[model samples]
Target chain A: MKQLVRVALLDSDSDVRFGRKMIISSNPKFEIVFESDGLSEDLVAVADGLIDVLVINQRLASGAGVSFYQSLRSLVGIKQATACVLTSAFDQPTLLLAALEEGVSQVVSLEQGPEALMNAIAAAKTGDQALSLGELYSLVLAETPSRELNQDLLRLVGDLPQKLESNLRRLQSVWKKGDAAELENFELKSLTGLVDKLPVKTASELVIRLQRSGLLDGE
Target chain B: MIRWIQRKNWIPEILLATFVFVVFGALDFATQGLLALLCSLVMSASLLFIRRFSFLTSALVLIFSTMQVSFSLLPVFALIGLLLVAFATGSFSQKPWREVNYVASVFGGLAFAADLAFNPTLDLAIFGGTIELTEAGRALTFVIFGLLAISMITLMWIFGQLLISRLLTVGSDIDRLAYEKQQLALSIQLAEQSKRFEIAGEINESVVQRISSVITNAEGGLYAAKASPEAAVRALEKTLSSAKYAHADLRRLFDMINLGEMVSSAPPSLEDLDSLTIAMRETGLDVSVSYFGARFALDQSAELAIYRIIFEALLNAKRHNPKGTKATIEISWLENGFQVLVKDNGVEVERKSALGANGMPLPYDVEDDIDSLLEKVTGPGITAMRERAESFGGSLEVQRAVGVGFTVSATFPVEAIRAAQDTSA
Candidate 1:
């Protein structure tokens, strides 16, 4: 009989909270102690620091949940609890990075299914960031404004174009390796997440053509 | 690109200055000594930098004219350059020199009169012929020519002043037209962008969120299916319901685009607040709107959005409270941004609650405490209002206190509203 991870979840949407609770409660290794639709005095009133994991949606009622968490640090409890943020959108890297920098344990995207969130929570308790910090960095780099990205690259590495080419070549080689066990790799899954987001007409046309040619399928 | 800033293109003035020195200066050299030609050369050269250094040029014009008057060698080139300098001073000179230019030109005119009166050889051929005169005749000549010279100099300077202002007015009109064109373009762009943002927000908050919820419910069902098939079926049924909502919302967005329903008439804005208050008052909610800072026109979409947000708050106040509920809506356009604060004496919930925990029409036939009263007001309406505010990079905060009542505060930064629009207020 392994010890179950006690979880307290807070999300602004009641439906989302119900869904998340159902998912967490189904897992025998994780037990939901408390849940709320949003941050409130009721949180401290009910389940103060007694839970193993505290999962908060990044966007709370007032503002960023990270700020709320920062304020919560002063409540003279919760020294044993770990916080994991469920980000709705990964477009803003500054906020994501801020969450990571503010000692948030994990940044799980809503796009990933319940499995990823469960893994993030389980990993948080074990003191592991196996969710791939490299993937996070790559996403951050991909989303950074071009001007600032160039300046940052200049500070760290020398030539921007050369570095970009090298990175592409390296990624190509990595894809060519095609190791069977690497199917679960985070990098491959997160490949060109931004490219998927960008609404380029040419790409859409190619995708349509491929689907018509039976080389692709509609999602 | 204002003409005043590019005053360095003094080619025409320089050409005229050189022409004056070459032709009239030759006459001065031929008539008076080398010193007279040199004096004429110096005055003509002042035109080179008149547009650039107005004060210096005007000063030089006055000094040399006085010297020529004292020397009794009123050169031909000096008089020609004086007219140009007077015009330049009126147009280009700033502050004290602009004022000093009038006195300088007058003095130059007096100098000319004196030169014509005392030195008969330098009388301007344009005005009259040189006449042999006694001491009394010279006195009479000075007074007669004084008026003509004074009027001529003053008129030239005044004409310069008028010409510049006329050019400026034309320039300003052109600038205004260009600005209006840009504003129209920007308004269209922002309207389109705002539509896109709203769509994104809609998809993000509702569709994507619902799909994510469905995924969670389905995953939860898969895990729960191992033990209890009936409960798993119920959880999986929720997935279908959630997916249907996501699909419907997504279709609604696509229909908005496909049906060309994106373009519509301008919505009601801040200007319609009076009518809004009237409408509210008619509904038995006394809503008073007070503007704190100097008010200016906001973007059509932003204005509409803000008006909608404020209206929602007032509506909340009305819906929550009894008839004749007094609500004060304060609009402040501060240096930071636009802020809307609406405070109302909400429903007196010291008595029994209107609705139950599930918001059904069933409630305990008992008195409610302050905490339960506060909890009862947390409705989906406020959440929707918050979503609307957040769509525009704004925030809405609701404060509920026992005696203090309910306050809904929303803020929109100028950057978010204006998109770099300038404001005098």
Candidate 2:
């Protein structure tokens, strides 16, 4: 007889936790030792002592899956427990890399259903890394090109701060004068052009921040 | 044709001369005065060149007419010559009122003296009788007539000055209004273009970027699920969560883009800093926030601008810095103003090289000025930050020194914030 793998489920959604609990119960080889809709002080305190595998949502109400996983690594008994991250379509490559760097052994997408969850637990029990094929392919495609591009971007924008300082000062003076017309007329094309040269991911992040701030597009 | 008419002084002057000649010559002919008609024709003809040599023409016409015409007919010649002198003085005089008054006074005095010396019983129409007066009475009468003539000339000169000044003022006002209208049109066009660019940038940053992220994560999950049965559940879970987030993000994007709904109900303020810090930390960034000095309220726009400046700085630090890099945000409220400083302890990436170590050429040259280069690479984020700060009469600074972490600081005058509070109250 095979040893049942002790499993702990952590998610912010009660329905998701209930559904996952039902799916894990079908597999006799997996034993649900602990489950919670959220990560609490109590859960973190007891999770290492009782569970062989920690299945957590990548996004928790309390914090990120990557950060939570990093915190778990410092806990007593969970140091050796397999940490599996569950992500959604909203996760970016940057997030995936962050989770992977934090020593998360398995990345599972909920869209893959019950079988995928079972497989991740099995792989975790054996101390083997389990990755979705899509993630592997994306990593392969994104890693090399992005690194090279990022390096190039880092070098290209090296003197950006010095260049923008004077204009910033001028803008400050104009603002102090309360001249809305001049502020509206002030040109930002050169700045936009420089940012366009950066890698897509980095540029997109900055651009999104600008959009949120009502900077990129006029309010 | 209109410009030519405006520029040529001779055309109007010649036309006036012709009208005067026809009127005066016809009158002389009807009276059977041949010499008088010839004198009228010659005087009118000379008036055409009055603008060219106004003083010379006036003196010559007066002297010649005084000698050739009878004393009674001399008044008619003197009238024609005075008309020419007034017209020339009006056109040529820089100080028209002064010049016309001086010339008119002299002409009136000379006419009185000439009548008194040449014709004793000068049928003084104004006095109503040809009184053979004593020498004292004749001198007094000459003085009375000269004074009346000077008073009449002064009145006409004053009226002419008022009319000319009024016309000039109207013409200048019309020109100014036209220039203002043109400037208004240009500014409107520029504002429209700016609005379009802003919309495009927003879509690119929020909608497009979020969709792309969704697609990438979906593909990653699908491939992972298909590769190994053991990894299927984990991959599927991620795909589901990502899909859900994508749906929510898309709905938000649509609301903003299609319905023009505002994403934030109220503009974020300093009180919202804790949430912003938490959000960054959720992205696996090590974010810390500290406040120093007294906390005070700011107006909506100023608060929003300050919030955005700090938000962008923190986001930039989180995106560029390595995982676990510590980002610290400090808010210092001084006596007269407030300052926000965001600092990150991350890798000090060199930002000046245009070429790679292997001699690979870059899109931009190494020699490009820092301003243009930074503008190109950082895009509108920094520019927008500076603009927001400036919009509220504040200042923002970014520092990136070799071997040192990146720092962004923004300072705002407290008066603006306080003024906002006063208005709200």
Tens-digit lDDT track of model 1 for A1-219: 899898878777666676777777878899988777656573464346577777887766655677656556545332433455444533355565556544466667766677888888887676554335234434434554222222432233233256444543444344344343442353422323322332211222212222223222211
The candidate 1 chain B region of ten consecutive residues with least summed lDDT is B258-267
- TM-scores of chain B, in order: 0.42, 0.36
Per-residue lDDT tens digits for candidate 2, residues B5-50, read 3478789668767777788777765653676677666666656655
Could you give candidate 1's per-residue lDDT for residues B148-226 as a string of tens digits? 8778877778887898787786657556655653553344445545675677566657777777778777777887787
Runs in model 1 with CA error above 4 Å? A45-47, A77-80, A83-95, A130-219, B1-203, B255-425
TM-score of 1: 0.38
Model 1 / residue B50 / CA error / Å? 34
TM-score of each: 0.38, 0.30
- The DockQ for candidate 2, computed on C-alphas, is 0.02
